[model samples]
Target chain A: MHGDRLLLGPGPSVPYPEALEALTRPVLGHLDPDYLGVISEIGDRLRAVFRTANALTLPVSGTGSAGMEACLVSLLEPGATIIVGVNGYFGERLCEVACRGGAEVVRVEAPWGSPLDPADLLAAQRANPQAALLAVVAAETSTGVRNDVAPLGPELAGTDTLLLVDAVTALGGTPLEVDEWQIDACYSATQKCLGAPPGLAPVTLSPRAVERMRARRTPIQSFYLDLGLLQDYYLASPPTYHHTASSTLAYSLHAGLGRLLAEGLENVWERHARIGAMLQDALPGLGFELIAPERARLPQLTAATLPEGLDEAVLRKRLLTEYGIEVGGGLGAFAGRAWRIGLMGHAATERSVVTLLGAVRQLLG
Target chain B: MHGDRLLLGPGPSVPYPEALEALTRPVLGHLDPDYLGVISEIGDRLRAVFRTANALTLPVSGTGSAGMEACLVSLLEPGATIIVGVNGYFGERLCEVACRGGAEVVRVEAPWGSPLDPADLLAAQRANPQAALLAVVAAETSTGVRNDVAPLGPELAGTDTLLLVDAVTALGGTPLEVDEWQIDACYSATQKCLGAPPGLAPVTLSPRAVERMRARRTPIQSFYLDLGLLQDYYLASPPTYHHTASSTLAYSLHAGLGRLLAEGLENVWERHARIGAMLQDALPGLGFELIAPERARLPQLTAATLPEGLDEAVLRKRLLTEYGIEVGGGLGAFAGRAWRIGLMGHAATERSVVTLLGAVRQLLG
Candidate 1:
């Protein structure tokens, strides 16, 4: 009766059993030839997944938040002028990390369920022409709006300002052209659409980003997140090991990315869109309302408002406790207003979509 | 004949099968009651392992290097003065990370295979009395020199300067008295003597360190290594889930730390000592010379000068290819001359020690 259960959470979703097995594989030294071979494969996969020819593509040995920290701090040195696009909880978080890095941050604001217009962000950049870096979230998981970074970077074209992005939830489930978009430094986590366990963060640096880091007036204020030294470890010849990456994690990410590549990136995105469509269409029938505007929605994720009288916390508890189905309630500004349902990786399936809808329908009945 | 050959490297050593098995255990959500309980228990065990009564003990979701960055960057602000003890490769690394945090670094030099004489370091501190922090490695794994951090702080007692210690190779294998020594901030990794695979770093900070961070005029420049926000995330009532922890990595570390605790910290350290003693005593018989003075020696690790006429790299190659054993060659100052034999974690069994001794003997003949 119970072989496996579908994972339908905002994140920390279920991984393929093969990915789980990758965690148990015999641990090898970080610098061992066999492990380096695995790491080399990881770099290629990270580049393909990031969709960049950037030579600095590799995993940062930390979690999703670490990814955010690495990208922001390494790209913008202390006192560097930057514009942070704050639309959701994650964007606000970017502002915090950027502020901590001693950047003079100018926040380009859009309220929680709304996406910032790329044109407005460009206007702010023009007004604050001293801004050397522009940061945005390609997929704002907190509010379920997939900001289009591709067109946004074009407006910053011909300017020395580098475009950085957080693609933590969008890599496999959504189409992101890092090169085509002219995004400078981008980082992502393994837990979302990759279906790998959470730990390592994949990151890339455009030549412009690397060049600016070299020319920075101040050292990248973090040694660990300093891409300057990290480049020595991850991108240098002989591939000097920086941090001890649990080689086991790279194995799982390798396996997860393998599955995604086999499935074809386009098909993976299409699958997410279809499953998201199914859930989005069915949730309204169960008396739920989608949070973000339909046009700007992320295909792999959905944020829905609870029915007028239903207790959001109570229903979330009941879903986890009674049904073993997991989901995320609203975060930060949207607290008590929206439930985030993710159709990431192995969780993006017709069965999962139908089952979650069925479970909510019965609960509503 | 078919059993897996043992790993006796500097780190990522062969973990016990049980430890590897823990990695495959189904991962629960970061906030799952069961997972949180395990994380809490690991914290308790780490405090015991670190011999710290500090209230801020917890694991950072990164490697030992991350632990290093977490400790250094948390309280260090732009323009802070820090004195770093640089003896070998890792100490130089510490200086680099600290300098990147915008600290004016004063190097307290100790020769490779020699401990940082407390008197010399004290003189440096007295000269730089306004230094905000003092950083030293208790166990300098690069040179197999275990410095006495025990007395490094006594001279600066009652001063405002915080004592920072890196016990990456010392935490579970050597004597570390964080409370008795008045260490304000200390960080350790999981892979070295802890018997866990390398992934997360368990760090502890005294109230003084927290107070320092709280009073910082500038923000902790590195966001990934920022301890202030991480403290709120790890210690918040009903822990705020910031990043999805590698639940299995945490679980495996819990199991390793649990087993280490059950065996008792004193006994686990004694085990490393006894096995290391066997390797150290047998080195002369293999025509290898011990590097560090007996009194300054790290009992869990032995650095031996390669035999004349033997290319250390050649021997290491044969050892890994033939015996499936991996040991470290010297880095930086000692490179091409010495080999580092580690009796770390589950790899420190008497049988493995005797086996390695015998292998070196055979190769020598």
Candidate 2:
């Protein structure tokens, strides 16, 4: 086993103690009655966390990117038009996956470190009034920006367009209401703020999104990600065989969600908000400049430029080797010039912040 | 955590103790240098287990089915012809997924509980000589039959068609030589004979299969399963980030493989064969009829028809509730009639066979 290191990277934040304990439980068959009960409980927990009444809510059997692929492939068919807000790495990825599935993409642009304007996204949807979906990242992990997802949802109400949100880094750490925000679909990763290992992608789809999926003239491009088939296995009586799901991962996620809900969603959000503020508040004093604008920043993840005249890779390597703290390197425009520090889930604590800051101060000196 | 129950199903038999312990180890960043070392070790061990020196061997992030999708979408372009041997549920699934990717499938058929005749597969391939791929299941988990995958590979050696094998139930539990058998692309699940949880699909592709993937005319249909991009992430220096892999699962699989290699592959295979024989030999005495013919039966999975007038579901449930043993129900032709009992990986032991038989005998009385 590798030595324990503080994970302050973009994601895969430190796992909860309960989750780690759950992983050691004896293996259960996917269709076992008791195991199915665990799955049902997980679904219920996901619903409460997503703040949605969608009956189709469940964890997809892959990571966050698989969740993204599932949503795109399930809803978008050939020749369909989608309006995607592109401000960071994930948004660009949305366009790439949509295009591969034969959808025509209309991009709404914003600077890398700035949130996409809700007005611009709605305008794009209006121009392509027949667009099937409008997708935005609720929290952009790449740039630490929180797009204005709430505004776009209300505007798309009763329109042909469905609002799809990427909540990979935003889910349990920030304020997100799938039902209240009128999000047709949302996908999140367990490793982020969910305090579990990175294997499952919890996704919720509204009635309208399911309707669009059923109404598709062409077959879904991916049989594995096809929500229709997955629903048969997850929700059907005497569930049919879909695939051999990882019951071990499900058990771990169940424990993690149980811990989160016990702490209360509002309380969990508050803790993250406070912890994120502490780190963000201290970075500037240490010569690190925050990437996201003040109004658009995400609390769970912070992207900051390193102090001038220090090699980013060299310093990050020292932080890892000497201090055993892992921070993320910048992507796209910030490559080699910035660090992405994540204070999420179990790692979102005052102690972690103090330790990381002290380590950075020592390295910089 | 759920109570411990013996998993005697098609796949996900039971996890090794070492695997369970490994899962409890600290979670690592997906790209951590030490975690990367774990990945590299896994690749080396997988190469040893797969019995091939294929450079593209790596685990896909989803279950065994995702591995199937990866091989199909990676190599077969739209409108490509694929000759698939359809003798069980997974074979039918192969045709379904291939068709979803826009490939025209020509099926070579056999009875549900019977193995596909290698001569018939050869005949189909010869008739459709321009076929891009010829696919078959090395072990048909749905019916407990081991199809002849070795003959087809040598026949297609000089042809343009690639030989794809589904070793989901065959790998590690039985003799499989990818290099000696000339199999081009093969995929298996960690949950089956690999003694790990059902979250990863270990796949190996020969150089010729890689050549066909590179020569694809159109973009691969699924971006998540695109082997070229996955290869870049798994093999490239300064690896590009494709998705957040579960290091926890990798550690579990690594430990499982290590245990298997330490036991020696031939010894592991012999244990499974002996245990399977003990179970099969006792079934007939218990008024059960074996499904697969003697020559085609798989040592890892045994399909048998229960005594007349006994409800299959009730008996299985009794075994679960009264004895805490989980066995599989039949699919396709044997639905509600046959049981698929698997003794795979760590579950393949003389004690397991004796316990299962004792429970069956008691329930029958």
lDDT of 1 by residue, B1-365 (tens): 12244677677767766678888776566766567677788778888998877778889989998999888888787788898888877889899888877779999998888888878878888888899898899888888898888887777777768899999988888888899998999998888888888889999999888988988877676666778877876777777656778777888898888888888999988898888888888888778888888888887778888878899988987787778778888877778988988888888888888788777777767
List, residue by residue over A72-187, the lDDT tens digit for candidate 2.
99999989999999999999999999999999999999999998989999889889999999999999999999998987778899799999999999999999999999999999
Worst 10 residues of 2 chain A by lDDT: A1-10
TM-scores, all candidates, are 0.96, 0.99
Please, what are the lDDT tens digits per residue for candidate 1 over residues A72-122?
877786688889899998898898888877789999988888888888789
True contacts kept of 2: 0.84
Model 2 bad stretches (over 4 Å): none
Give candidate 1's error at residue A97 in angstroms. 1.6
The Cα local distance difference test for each model comes to 0.82, 0.93
Q: What is the alpha-carbon lDDT for the whole of candidate 1?
A: 0.82
Best by TM-score: 2
* Clashing pairs in model 2, backbone N/Cα/C closer than 3 A: none
- Going through the candidates in order, the fraction of native interface contacts each one reproduces equals 0.63, 0.84
The candidate that achieves the highest DockQ relative to the unseen native structure: 2
